[model samples]
Target chain A: MNWKPDKNKPICPQLCEHMSVLIASGEYNPHDKLPSVRDMAISAGVNPNTVQRAYETLEQQGLIYTMRGSGRFVAEDVSVSKQSVKTLRFEKTEEYFSQMEALGFSKDDTKNYVKEW
Target chain B: MSELLRCEKLTKCYGTKTALDEIDLCLESGKIIGLLGPNGSGKTTLIKLINGLLTPTSGSITVCSEKPGPKSRVNVAYLPDNSYLNNWMTVKKIVDYFKDFYEDFREDLAYEMFERLGITPETRLKSLSKGNKEKVCLILVMSRNAKLYVLDEPIAGVDPAARDYVISTIINNYNPDATVLISTHLISDIEQVLDEVVFINNGHIVLQKTVDQIREENGKSVDDLFREVFRW
Candidate 1:
């Protein structure tokens, strides 16, 4: 769950990455209230809007819930977390496999490479 | 219901060139409107006129039954294309200034927005990077509970990620009843949020329609229509 900021990455994406790491690390537990939007924005050195967007995205992903005039909290379950990770990993693996096949690598070569690594 | 903004034969002139020519625009409440135009096509001029920062050469603009003036300005929140803050001020000081100027200014909301952006009260406007500065400007403008919000080129210079965040911020913070007029050349990213789209070219409004109607009648997205209408 360790996450380091990549200087090349845009601020909001990096912020989202950092937040994800924090969530995966259990630093922000399920149903835990995150900091206020403004507070998070200042700490991240980004526009509040960017942080707001990230929060909205997380909510849409079912990783968070927002209560009007209250605050946003982590979702009560890890289903979203598992789904997101599985989906992301599958997509990446599919892409990588395609590239390996395109480069003339056989199934045996791929299996051998995986075994070796 | 009263209109949020009304412009009739609005003409704005520079020293020798006309920036806006006989433009007539009417905006209602509770909708996000896109003002699309190429550079130097008078989008900024039109916004400036509505914000009462620039006087029109020969025309009329009324916001909420009054002419564009100090009273109207009080009800409007404007974000210029460029940084308009005094470079010497700290973020905290700027918040104070806004509190003094805008009756609806919410200090707590500004502070919250600042926190979300990871900006501090101690942060000096001059010391901030360009992107952070823009964020601060946006936070200040959006913190206000104004009747009309005018944002000119809100996402022009920012990175794609930042642009998305800015759009999200607008969606999250804007008062549902307020009228938002956003002018930008990047139409696709914002077309989804707009209730209406107004296309301008050569200092004139070429088309205006509700986003739904545009989609229905033209069988095209607002972005597609924009590309076609403003095509070379």
Candidate 2:
């Protein structure tokens, strides 16, 4: 998918994209505490408000947790982490399979392609 | 006991520009304080100063009787207007981090939130769509058991459906004894839950009153008053 940055797009979208990559790549583990808002804003080169929006977005998704005084962190659940990764990969696989089918690739051909890989 | 938050002649400047002009305010616990203002009115600047994210040019701000610092931060849960998560961490990793850092964090609540939102821990922050990311952030902030919760713009950019969820989460999750200060230009959506509303114009607080008092005196909703006070 083409993920070009649009100036009109809010900062939350961009920040979320960065976070998604981190989570998918396993750079941050489950139940790991995140840095402060000020620190993240400075590092991301965005306004604190924008960073705050992203954190809120993340919270709504249940991917991270925030503590009153300490700061935001990754949720603590291995099963959740596995399930999230599985869902993501499954969705992508479904998309690819659907696209291949649309291009007239038969099931046999698809199976052969998978085997070749 | 002293007020939960006390700001006495607090001033903040950005070079030659004065963002907050000697503002004095007191916030008590168990109340939802709405910080309302127009664009460039320094509402955000004042919030930053109180949270210790920005130093005031003059005057002082006290949270629970101590100056705003690491000590004050422990009791304050701040939600800025943007995302603060590192793009590299997985949802599970973020949760693990919170458990380690916050002594009062409840793992069960976090899990319940995940179930409610259908968010899986294995998902990478980058994989989820824009709306889902914001939801993740909201769940995290609301899970904390803080004494003061500062939400800069809890519902700004998202579909209408998601806005309802965000607002509901905030109302349902907030601790009744904690102080919640929400700053936003979108007043109508949040006015119903706010116990008190404070209006700022040109970096100065123009009005501060209880929701009931405002309605009784002005015979208008907080949004209407905001429009009248901030009419350009």
lDDT of 2 by residue, A1-117 (tens): 233333323345556766765665677788777766656654554434445767888777777889888888887643444566677678778888888999999877887999999
lDDT for each residue of candidate 1 in B1-232, tens digit (9 for 90 to 100): 3489999999999989999999998998766788998888888888888878899899899987778898888889999989988999999999999999999999998999888888889888999989989989898998999889999999989988888778767766644468788999998777655667898988999988866567667767777878888788
lDDT of 2 by residue, B76-114 (tens): 778888888878899899888887877666678877888
Q: What share of the true interface contacts does each candidate keep?
A: 0.00, 0.00
| Candidate 1 lDDT (Cα, 0 to 1) | 0.80
lDDT of 1 by residue, A1-117 (tens): 233333323334456656765676688899899998766754554445456778887787778899889899998875666666566568778888889999999867997999899
Stretches of model 1 off by over 4 angstroms after superposition = A1-117
Query: lDDT values of the candidates?
Result: 0.80, 0.76
Tell me the TM-score of each prediction against the true structure. Answer: 0.66, 0.65
Provide the DockQ value for model 2.
0.01
